[model samples]
Target chain A: MEDKVKIIEIKKSVFAANEKTADDLREELKQKGVFLLNVMSSPGSGKTTTLVELINALKDKIKIAVMEADIDSDVDALTVAKKTGVQSIQLHTGGMCHLDAEMTSQGLNGLSNLDDLDLVILENVGNLVCPAEFDTGAVTSLTILSVPEGDDKPLKYPLMYQVCSLVVINKIDVLPYFTFDVAKCKENIKMRNPNAEVIEISALKKEGIDKLADWVLKQVKNWKENK
Target chain B: MHELGIVFHIIKQVEEVANKNSVKEVTKVVLEIGEVSGVVPKYLHDCWKWAVENRSEHMKNCALEVISLKATSYCKDCERMYDTVKSGRICPYCQSKNTYLVTGNEVSIKHIEVKDEN
Candidate 1:
């Protein structure tokens, strides 16, 4: 006797529904006049340090808030709040390595100062592979690529480089110490995403912070003017 | 890795589809994962084996099948397509710098098999 089975074709992405939810969340954030930016990087890529500088640069100009995502720790959120004195919240991913659009929306709802904030920065968990796959409903997506991570990262992890609107080459101050070539990195990034804007900065030394801040200001202004 | 989370997401989708069609027991789940989608098939299988047992009563002992899609890139100047992992954004035919990915960046559920009601 043969066991009976029925084949059902369901050619659907597990992420399709998440993408729709992300688009809706983007529209909602637009209506509420909030520019959300998702920042991703590998562990110890100086994301929190870079974010501290960014918050300082834009704090006087606009109302800012931060959501720090980690697999288990809330230390980054505490650091951001202590250093910036702004509305900051910690999002424990509960073993989820990346934050999806629904998780981002839930995080936004958890923030009590959404009405008073102009920008919401999601400091995504430090991991290159997973965070890039999920859209967190942000207006812009940025990735921090430090010098120590090597220049061939764009070629190895092309998806992360491709999805990012901006790629910040952090730790430029340590460029002399490492064998990282800025031009090579830029070329590789261009191959993945021709339109991605690349900026070199050292969050520790505060070099190129102005350029990054200017770009963020422009993005925020564009979001405000267009939406 | 985040493969466990991905497994949960897939199970959720499968459960939703099963409920919509009134499927009592899911016997198999076919997933189409691209070569460059960042999901390790072995890890995914491991997670599926664990999560399926714990997810739903109908999904117990379900078999997960994965089909790998090749990553291909298209060269603009050479107008040729090559395996992305082997070529690395350079057109092997013409050695052109202007190249872009064409496929192999997908992660989706393609098919589901259910046991017939006796």
Candidate 2:
């Protein structure tokens, strides 16, 4: 007797399951009137400093919280808590490179007073690659690129730029020291993503923080008011 | 690495399908991986081997077969398709950056091979 083998068709993307979960999570957040923003950047790209500045600028107008996702360590969450004085939590990915929809939902649940919060900023793991691939159920995605990291980053990491709605060019205060070109950087970003808005900032020096804050406020308002 | 995460998702999906079909064992899984999907096939295989043995019940010792797809992009200016890996976002013929990827970014499961009781 010969062994029998049957083939079953299961044509689906590997991300299909997660994508569905992300969509459902987005819908739920929408119903609850909460806006989620997933922030991605390379290591030491001034994400923590930038967040502190932006959160301080908007903390008065709206209720906000920050979830810092890292493979290990809780320093980011603590910094955001101490500096901006908003609700903050640390999510340990257990050596994973990125946060998926489920982890994000779990983090959201762990926050105190979730209903009262208007916006949640998810500071994703400091990697340019994996973070962009996984949808963290955020209403919008932002990527931070510092001037020292070079202007051709958009060309190198095309997918990251393509997925991000906003790209913050940070550390502009040190631009004179590096061979970074602002116009060329903007052109590269536009090539990859035409609609993605680029804002130049020096998070350390607090340059362009107001424009970034206004952008966040508008996004939150639109997320709440729009059908 | 993300390959591990992706492998976990694949295992979960395969488990659901096996449970739904009442499959006792899955011997093989076929995947369609695009050239520019950013997933390395070598890492995916390594992750799959570990995950199937440790994490999955019905897919123990399952073999993973990957079908590599060529990445192609459509140039809006010239209205032509070219190899994405070679030309990237900019079209080779017209040198226009106004282009979009048409294919080769997929990470899809095409089918599964299951063994039946005699």
lDDT of every model, 2 decimals: 0.90, 0.93
* lDDT by residue (tens digit), candidate 2, A36-75: 9999999999999999999999999999999999999999
Measured with C-alpha atoms, the lDDT of residue A163 in candidate 1 is: 91
Per-model TM against the reference: 0.94, 0.94
TM-score of the first chain of model 1: 0.97
Extract clashing residue pairs from model 1: none
- RMSD (CA, Å), candidate 2 to true, equals 1.7
Top candidate, metric DockQ: 2
Each candidate's DockQ: 0.66, 0.73
The candidate that wins on TM-score is: 2
